[model samples]
Target: MRKWGPLFAVSLAAFMLLIDITIVIVALPDMASDLGSSYTDLQWVMDAYALALAAVLLGAGALADRVGRKRVFIQGTVLFTAASALCAFAPNTATLVAARALQGLGGAAMFATTLALLGLAYEGRDRGIAFGVWGAVSGAAAAVGPVLGGVLTEHIGWEAIFFINLPIGLLAIAMAARLISESYGDREARIDVPGMVAFTAGAGLLTYGLIRAGGHGWGDGLAVGVLVGAAVALAAFVVVERRTAKPMLDLGLFRRASFVGIMAGGLFTQFAAFSGFPQVSVWLQSVLGYGPVKSGLVLLPMAATAFVVAGAGGPVMARIPPRYPIGGGIVCVGVGALLLTMVDAGSDWPVLVPGLVVIGVGIGLSMPPMSAAAYASVPPEKSGVAGGALNTFRQLGFALGIAVVGVVFRAAVENSIDGTPAAGRDAH
Candidate 1:
């Protein structure tokens, strides 16, 4: 119980950080109005964080191992707290976006360390339970982010969303310093600098291309150049990884079929889940004419259901094969999207609840098992790298998901508007 206390506290911090990633979406309008920014700037407010997170995660893990995980974790907490304060006080979109990017840097440090900490603190069933709890807490945070963001934005201001992290970050730092033990990965391995650069460049370019294409069309010259640059950079990354003595992400990990399948499943599940939420939130606000707080309230059940279901996955895994949960969970996500597809301008809270609940349960079941499976497949020495790689893919998937779904939603909204300009204009 004593050991578990630190694990729970760190996990809670992790949950808070992850939730902050999406929570700001509900408050975007208020933020834009307050700061007097354009839509592109609003998109930057989200993308900048994600880009920094994805860019630094693998390198951050290696750095954590080289230094001390506890030391790095505390540093990350301090940085995140400081960044949150900056975000709270940001006077313009540029400042807010810059602060968010710094926040992501801190978040990447903590995220890379926390999973490794979990690996150290618990074993077997206990470990499974810890991971389950981690997933549940994270899912719950994501679920409630909208509601919480909405309430804070409405009652106080958009700044409350960023300010809220200060206490949580401070508490996490204090607890980590006193309670957590130190851990590290293989220090002897050489850093794959070229691979890291190539991968980061590739991912950034690709993400930029997708996002720009969504707004400006694929024919846009900048979008076309970005896409080409991404492809070239990715090819160079593969080459660097193959030629390098020590690669950040070992290509050989994919040889194991179970690992490959589970990783693929993880990517797809995140892609689906990440894409669905923002689209739903937009529909709630733009189409249904709900205030941010009301939309958040409507999302509450989804988060609660995910928390309950995800926490149960650990116990269930003890009795059943992981594939059952993974497959079933993926199916549920698909079904939830299908239900969301049925949404129209007139749809209400009751009509949305069941689908959101189903989606949450599906996500809860899928995420933990996939993570556990991926972690378990690697050698103990390589767990840090493997975990880093898995998270990188998941982040990549999330970035892509947002781009893809934003495009879809934009197209749908435009088409709907084209059909009836008055209705579509009203909806926006």
Candidate 2:
């Protein structure tokens, strides 16, 4: 019980951070109206956090190892809490976007250190249970984000969604202080400055290009240049990482079959399923004529179902073969996405509920085994990097998923725009 206490606390903090990623999506329209944001700015509200998260994650793990995981975790919690306040009180889209980026920075620190902390704190069955609980919390949080955002946006304000993090953050901080002890690795690696620069720039350029292509046509020269530059920067990143004595990311982890497959599956599942929630939230509110609160209520079953399945998944995995649950889960997620494709302007709860449930279950089953497999395959020395890479890929999947899905959904909407006269066009 004592061993599991800190694990629970860190896992809880992770749950809060993951939840915020999706919570803001449902609140975006309300936020836009209040802040008077343009469509591009609204997209930035989502992208900025994701970009910052991906940018800092690789470095954050190394920093945690060099400094101390607990120390880094405390600093991150403080920063995240402060950033939440800034986001809650933000007066303009610019302020909110900046705050969200800060929040992501903190989140990267928190997430990167979390699993390492868990590994340090627990052993064997306790470790398994802790990770299982962590997985359940994450899935449940993702499932709840939409409903929570909707309810908060409708009842209090979009700001309430950000503000709610305050209590959770505070509690997690207190728990950390009480339950967790600090630990660090022996080797101290130098910062891979060039590698960080290349990776961040490459990811940013690619994401920016995708976002722009959603608004401007694909033929737009700036968009084309951005994408081209992204490819070049990524190539440079690969070169830089290989040559660096202390690489920000170890390139060797890809050699393990289990590691590679788990990472790939994680990316694929998130790319296919996780990206669709925000779009679904908007579709429910704008197209289905559902109120924010109602939209959230409609999503409650999905969250609830995921929580249950995810909680049970660990025990289930104990008895079953690893490949069966994970592979089956991936298939379930893909099938759910296919069903979701049936949703349109005229769809209702009946059409949305089944698909959401399928997705929730699929995600619940896939994530834990994949995560466990990734960790199991790595050498103990490289656990930190492996964990960071796994999370980096997961986050990258998220960012890429949103960018790609956003483009597809936006294009679909634009193409479907009927002969109705263009309404109040904003003065450029």
Question: On residues 230-330, what C-alpha lDDT tens digit does candidate 1 reach at each position?
Answer: 99998998898889887777778778888888777767776776666766776666666677888888888878887899897776764567888888888
Per-candidate TM equals 0.92, 0.91
Across residues 1-428, which tens digit of lDDT does each residue of candidate 2 receive?
A: 46667977887788888888888877877887899986568778887888778767767776777678888888898899899999999999999999999999999889888877877776666666766777788878877888888889988999999999999999999999889998876356666779878887886677677666655657889989998998999899899999998777777766867667888887788788778777777666665557777777777776777677778877567456568878988998889878888875555667877777898888888777666666666555445555666787788788677767877787554332222323321221
Off by over 4 Å in 2: 214-218, 318-321, 411-428
Pairs with steric clashes in candidate 2: none
Best by TM-score: 1
Name the weakest run of 10 consecutive residues (lDDT summed) in model 2.
419-428
The alpha-carbon root-mean-square deviation between model 2 and the true structure, to one decimal in Å, is 4.2
